[model samples]
Target chain A: MTAERSRLNLRDLLSETAVALTARPARTVLTALGTILGVGALVTTLGLAKTAGNQIVSRFNELEATEVVVSAQSTGFGDNTRSLNVIPWDAQSRLERLNGVTAAGTVSAVDVGDDLARSVPVVDPQGQTEFQIPVMAASPGLFGAVRASLFTGRYFDQGHEDRADPVAVLGPAAAQRLNVTRVDNLPVIFVGDEAFAVVGILADTARRPDLLGAIIIPNQAARDRFELGGVESVEIDVAVGAAELIGAQAPTALAPNNPDQLRVAVPPSPRRVRSDVEGDVNALFLALGGVSLLVGAIGIANVTLVSVLERTGEIGLRRALGATRRHIALQFLTESVALGALAGVLGTSLGVLAVVAVSATREWSPVLDSWLPFAAPVLGAVIGLVAGTYPAWKASSTEPIAALRGVA
Target chain B: MRSLRRSRGAPTPDDLDDGPLEAWAVPTAPAGGLSFEGEAVPVVVLHQAGRTFAGPPPVEALKPTDLVIERGEYVAIVGPSGSGKSTLLHLLGLLDTPTAGSYHLDGIDTVTLSEPERAGVRAARIGFVFQAFHLLAHRSIVENVMLADLYRPGGRDRRRERAVEALVSVGLEHRLDATPATLSGGERQRVAVARALVSEPSLLLADEPTGNLDTATGDQIMALFDDLHGQGLTLAVITHDRSVAARAGRVVGLRDGEVIEDRLVGSGMR
Candidate 1:
């Protein structure tokens, strides 16, 4: 009989807890909203941070694993500055002969005698000075190295580079500035009194983003017309895990006697980037989640206290029914924990939904913690248990006679 | 020492009862009540039991007094307001401790029991009904009766069956699922009585059970009490109304925290 009674106590407790909560549905729901918002904000922030961080680290790893850049060190300022170890005109061919080298290309800035190239024969009557376009000379492989995509016409071939024909391609920005949208018109742009026929307009580039705002001409043309020096920079793509090795070998390959004069740049190791990004993302959102949880805890405490005050008569009745002080305290604590558990379950689902929506809108793959949905409700319940301590104690301490006086 | 004296003499009411014999409106319960075999023990025995309030004035709420009530007896403690009728009831119900003297309930020394132990005794042996009917507004009449069983050592199904039987005994079986809010004043009081009876306690303690009802409704409730008393259930009612006191088999009157009169009604010396 004693065992059966004790077993039924749990069922009785739950039934009584449910009755108490349902007695004031509006108050219970409003009180639970605090935990809902807290948990939802926490989970949503976590989901977004992981998704964004994953994209950044993946891109960083991909670039760091395969690409290396070698630039000639500048000895002085201005157009007269001498390159201590200028990249050889045949830098691409030399680097390609090395193991693990997939592709290589050369690029050099064009010095147009301190004058900007203009498509118009004369200046506009309004005297607009917004079209100061910069120009660059590129080899054929530079287009492949930089991953450039053409918008119109065609890229200049090896035939044009070998004959030194003054053919050019305009970047999207440069093309807009020159009022040349299509290559069908065969537009001519003068570079320091020499006219070059525009062959193509580039839409975008992967490596050399700065090229979007400049014009490109054949390297042979720049060399013959302007007495251009050797290539200013060589960009090389190698197989994964070969960046450091190839970075060391490319400089020596380009300038065997002056390898120290060239600076080879490769991205930082992948391990470092992953930790840095993860740390930043976790720290930022964790604080926000913590603050939200604190506010939720306060809300639960406040509501539990108010409930204890309102149910003083009920407490007295239970006491009269032979409920000990501990029993009273346990009953109230159970009600609090039940409220928090409800909020946790609802909040976690809402948060997960929000994450899916945001990730879908941003075109990112959502990443969620595997155990968070199950753990969150338990955490909320624990918070409720802690928060209810004072109120439950106050309830249990109520003098049975004094409480009954109010009821009578 | 009191228990030793009682054991040595084994005195019945005919030998040396304290209260004087008198005639009253109600009759005593018949002999052959549900008698416990072996030895008969009074349900309540108070020897110089008194309660004092800890106050600026140190008010003595109940004066030291001796009282005894045997099983199957109907008793009423009658007094005006502030006469300590409620105080004496509080002591009898185990809701408060006396500042002076010892109290023995069901032949067990109660003064030595802890608060929780007192609560356990109350759960197993005493049933209380109040004037206001104190039914939980959110629960049905059946559920209200079932509250008593939650504290008892039994299966839920058995407890529920006992609650249903108690409600049927109180003529409230048809209104089992009706919440207190939907019940009339007299019906609500019946539910309270059913709740008190559900645990099959040894003694029924009621304080002003008809204080809040209309005279007609109050009379009906008193009639229900008389019927319960006729069935060999012991009852103690504390009230200010002489008319309510007239229906009991015995009456003890209080004035200024002291007992002024004690009397038996009808042909009642068991």
Candidate 2:
């Protein structure tokens, strides 16, 4: 017997593969759809992670890093006589005069003493959803420092503070509680029988969220009415990368004679927060992408198995034509890999288009890794290769004589 | 046409010394065991060849049967249903293995050959035409014929040319680009013949070549086989029809897995 070395003809195999796929066009398309969606989702998630992470890092890198909070430290007195350093009323102006400080404000908590705020004269005991809101006093720059949005007229200014006028700004939650919707109606709320005119309502604040449910008054007005004991803390907004400098110099700026009495708190580094956010986002999206890929692989395997079964006659014919089992296996494997590659190309285009469209609509710069589009196709081919192995084996292992029995 | 190359490590049989390309052109007029040179090497020889189906209880499809088919001999293996004609045809075509005894094709002992070695022998020296005319429906007639050249040892640069020549030989050159679905039954059978001839095999095995055709079309196909046989092509046709068997130079008859009769076509009646 002639023991000839066998080799598969690549051109003929490809032609045969092409004919096989085109013979059942609908099945081919349906099978490819699974891979398309899988690859598209994977590419989309990777692109969005980069885009969203960049925005998050850049957003927090500036203001969040530059922010510093200085608070009063209580000095322990002998025999429980607590002596706390009081922040001066002009501390906002003093800290603002520093080189790197952009905006500063003196924040003091007013002792409301279980007092209820109401738009009407009397507080009914049986009223539903009673409002026992906290009260606080701060300079006008508090609006800019905390990045608060105004729902109405304005914040209390320096003129109001100098005059010690009973002007107040209600938080959005507090305004809702007291039924004060419009400041133009000359709204007034009674704080335990003492009246204060409403000037503005704060919608939201990023830095100071507690202020969203509180009543805010001018420092001078709080001192007059509640005998606001002492300046509580100072909130300072500095220039980018200037938080360290400002924090070091803040205590001296607020209380020059006894700088050691004050304590300064700096915000966390932007790098740490950026890495943490990226890690969480990547893990979540990767899991989703992985699930999609697994589903796609299963779809490929199922369709390939069915194709093998359907082409038993062809496999027999090829074997009769002197094709080895390895040749048959290679043919099927190449077809699957080709299908996967096609899906990869199409899916990547779709994903890129989606990212561009969404980012354009949202006014965000689309950020994607440069190599993703190129590598995604290879990854898809590998998935297809792995998925096709069993089906190819089944196709190759078909008994030649048994297969020919069906033909004749 | 590109000159064919020999396989690297394969043992070359005596007849193949002239190469498969030259084998196609060599005349085969002097019948029986002897070629024109008076060499008595049979193309196919079986020594008690038989096939048993592996079953819950093993069934012997072909009982130890002996047969010999010489070069240039037009032979027909005829039998009724379950007579083991198909089993014998499959063994002769190298499509199956004999469960008992030995088989030699073109001077090569095939009983102990490896799968790939058997396939190599099949590709280089054997051709098959099935009853169903199993043409790939998606391919044009020429492409179907070109399938034979795909397994050739060297790169196939003249496949289109060779396929065209084979189709012309079978009188289907006019339908080169036509798909099998568009062809008539006889024309499809002709395309299958062209595919079988494209490899220039030493022995041509046809299993019920006209089984699916009308009597008139089957007559036409038999005429085509006659023309091929006239050109010195060795043909073995397996059929149940007596008319198909009448055309062969010799007939081997089977009944109940045994060769009941073996005779020249007219000598049995005479």
Candidate 3:
């Protein structure tokens, strides 16, 4: 008899592995669950990190980087003579004419004693509790610069400022305190015996949230009634990427004669903050994904080892039928790798679906790498190969005689 | 002899009228005295082959024994429990190496061959049928048969054709797509036989071929074995049943790891 060497072709090995794995459908699914969850978690976390980071950076750019504040530097003196009335009356128009500036306005406190500004026409003789609300004055363009939304009625316009109209805009909190909810009836509030008509109620402001609790009157009105002199600060809303240039030009534009008397404050660049936030979010999620993947790998290893033990008879029978040790080991290894690859595909699909579902609910755009789906299955196969090594070796080393005799 | 046959609950040689003895009916040397001249070399040759299990006190499972099986011969290795029958079968199947002595298969020195080489020899030259049927239960009958040639060098279609032919020879052509679980005990054994024959090995080694079957089913399997032997396939069956041993052309009685008897029995017709 010619001595013929035994051989196992790739086609047969794969077919045999397929048969073995598909024979028990339930076990196959159960064995693949860990890998599925691990890969799915990985993809979902990565997608959300990118998508959420983009959302945060865009919002930050809108609120922070687009705003520039120019304040008058107060001279070091107990008296207010030198520091008073330094800003031009045409500060809003002067800054707004700049190329990058969207809207600009000047604001100042009226300097009326806080408790003296009462909502009622007559003070109570019984010494009733009083609301100490601070009153401020702003130009018409301040509302636009601050991105203030109105709850009801309209803002006092340039016409009101030009005529020095005694119209007032109440912040939502101020409106609540003064018991004024609507401007349709033209409700009035007495500030130190001067009745001002409430024209609008502020709903929200994007830049300065502190202004939400104060009462705002037209700058000309504040100047005429309360003798408000110097402008405090000019708020300018510039287009994105234009804040730095406007910050540099605003001080000179507002006080060309005394530019040093004005100080410009532009928001710090958002690039560093965006990167830091993204890095933190990505690192946190990636750690979680890695832990999940490790657990999945452990699960695969455990299941493969158990399967090797359970299929000892099959391994022995193959040996008796001319299978070498390497053939037996390769059969098992290929089975696990196939299982992992199939799980990876399923996990990637599930992860993509999860990202889409979450983004839809939150109204955010989902971001994922184009190659993630293609690479996930390969990652899963590598995990499977690693997990199956010891178990395949164990299978290969089983004694055929003992195994066939049902002794193990 | 009558008392022995009655005690064993099996028929004597005289009770079988299976035609005249064939030319291979004459028994060869009982203990290593045969010469290899110009005749076809024996399919199996064991010279003082033995096996011992390692232990604090090593257990000798099989003593040094000499046996030669020629081509197309039907031999039965019969022994009671704990009589080295399983040990000798393991040795003959090359599932374990002999601790002492030498074994030659088709004139190749098997003892000196590497483990992988031994596996190659076993795959190409030996067919085994176990008492448990040893068929992959999940596979179709034809697929189970085809598994025998999975490690052999051949095209898939050719291997499939040979598998179908082997199944047809075992009268299982109709159950080609049926799983082993769907088959009866005898049909399962027949499928196992088909799987064994798929590789066209020189020697068929069956370990307790009918230990799990009823007497009638066992008889059917033995009849199939007789048919295969008539077609000039060499077979060595290890069984504890006297009736099973009585069906072979020669019987080698083993007791406590020693060969006690070697003699010709049933009509060896071809």
lDDT of 3 at B225: 91
In the predicted model 3, the residue pairs found to clash are none
**What lDDT score is found at residue B197 in candidate 2?**
79
Per-model TM against the reference: 0.65, 0.66, 0.66
Estimate, for each residue in A57-122, the C-alpha lDDT of model 3 and write its tens digit.
666656778899998877766755344456887899999899999999887777885545456544
**Ranked candidates (DockQ, high to low):** 2, 3, 1
Sliding window of 10 residues with minimal summed lDDT for model 2 chain A: A1-10
Regions of candidate 3 where Cα sits further than 4 Å from its true position = A58-271, A283-287, B1-39, B155-157, B268-270
Model 1: docking quality category: incorrect
Ranking by lDDT: 3, 2, 1
True contacts kept of 2: 0.47
lDDT of each: 0.78, 0.81, 0.83
Interface RMSD of 2: 2.4
i-RMSD of model 3 (Å, 1 decimal): 4.8
Model 2 spans with C-alpha error above 4 angstroms: A1-3, A60-271, A279-285, B1-40, B266-270
Model 2 chain B scores worst on lDDT over the 10 consecutive residues at B1-10
- The alpha-carbon deviation from the true structure for residue A155 of candidate 1, after best TM-score superposition, in angstroms, is 36
Instruction: Return the top candidate by DockQ.
Output: 2
